[model samples]
Target: MGAARAGNGSDGIATNLPEADDYCLTARDIRCVVLDIEGTTTPIPFVTDVLFPYARSNVRAYLVDTYRTRQTMDDVAFLRAQIDKDLADGVPSAVLVPPPSAPEEEVIDALVANVEAMIDADRKLPALKQLQGRIWRLGFDGGEIQGVVYDDVAEALARWHGTGTVRSYIYSSGSREAQRLIFGNTEAHGDLRRYLSAFFDTSVGGKREPRSYYEIWQTLGVDSPSQILFLTDVYQEATAARDAGFEVLISIRPGNAPLPEDHGFQTITSFAQISV
Candidate 1:
């Protein structure tokens, strides 16, 4: 929802998958692993059901309050550009900027209004990602929301990092600050941030694009994609990572994943079983 499926691997690699292996990294071949949030570590519902909506509800307020800030002005540019593109396609401003609150369609209507303007202005941007991230920050800090990590994640990550050889990271559409907030606020062993080394978001070309992973590799100064293990619940995302040469792991867990008959990769249920 942020940009990519929450499975880039981990804080170390860049995904959160439903399944992992018992013989992959094994505390030797690799020094770092990237993990994803969402379905990989934190359950999808926490993100979708709570984080997304909370941010959605607060975006309007953020826009109004921050509209004068340099960042919000950037969002205006973002919205203008989106508007221009839609207009070029024969759309009209009437649909672009509807009345402030159109009942059940207020939120979406606002988005359309801003997006149309963005396309019109020719600005491909990250205003929304930024705004949502900021709003979510307050919610997280307020204790209005709680991040959920799978039951098995705590011990596995603890053991993996406890080896003192492996490093972990986080990559998600969420902002770097949001990543810290979630991990730091997680129900499992509060403040997991110390275990993580870095954070990434859609600014990295997004997960669907192969270049994001490449950028990650460059940031890590890692030798090769093959040296890092990319984990996720979405096969399409794993495919992009695999294409980039990062070792791939799939996560399959109850209520989190839809079973695939021919995934063509290793699957895992918990971090406790992961190996390298």
Candidate 2:
């Protein structure tokens, strides 16, 4: 599938549906590119199938092994605070984290239970993502996990970086550390981090919220929102970026969730289609 004309007649939005031609970006004065990870640069299956499972299955051992370390203690404290709020707000599957004085096994068990639940629910809380990033760090360092990206990603990143005008960034729900770990350890590319200028996560704001894009635009220090191009696989995200005045493109990738029929956004199957 190529670019699908968005039905919504927003001013400056592309409305031409090209059957065979890829959506061209050369016409736009895009100075910065903000990319989404899951379902856009990386396959959804790599996250849902491999990454999540690795974190879920190894969380217990990780907690047990690192229990007394300062980092683990901080992680536990953060999760405890989050779970306390969740329980107060009546969030389902929110488990009680035992106190630090509790038996080590008991504390580890409670933390693991809550972590697994968060993983299953795919919660975007900073506590959860921070812990997951640390866990994945071990796996990546040990050569147990290798980051996976679309074949077109590394080349496009290189091309954009080579231009000296278009800067590339990643804005994902994944913590910035996790984003680095993924891009820094890819098998085929072998350290794509050099091409990325910076990373943004939930600390900025939720991806679907327009204000998040506004925050990113300000941080990028670009001439205008129109100077940035946001690529994502979800319609809501594309809409959010567009509302923030950034040009948007919806990525069409295998195993990605279906978009609404009337979701009026240009779509691209490969980053190679995008010209800086």
Give Cα-based local distance difference scores for all models.
0.68, 0.88
* TM-score for predicted model 1 compared with the true structure: 0.76
Model 1 spans with C-alpha error above 4 angstroms: 1-21, 86-125, 257-260
Model 2's C-alpha root-mean-square deviation from the true structure amounts to 4.6
Tens-digit lDDT string for candidate 2 (1-276): 454454422233334533324645567888899999998999898999999999999999899899899999899899999999999999889888778888999988888888999999998999999999999999999999999988899999999888888899999999999999999999788999999999999999999999999999999998899989999988899999999999988887776776777566767778888865
Model 2: pairs clashing at backbone N, Cα or C within 3 Å: 6-264
Worst 10 residues of 1 by lDDT: 1-10
lDDT of 1 by residue, 30-142 (tens): 66678877788887878767876787667666666665688666655665555556667775542453433445345345664554343344232455555566777788888
Report the lDDT of model 2 for residue 110.
82
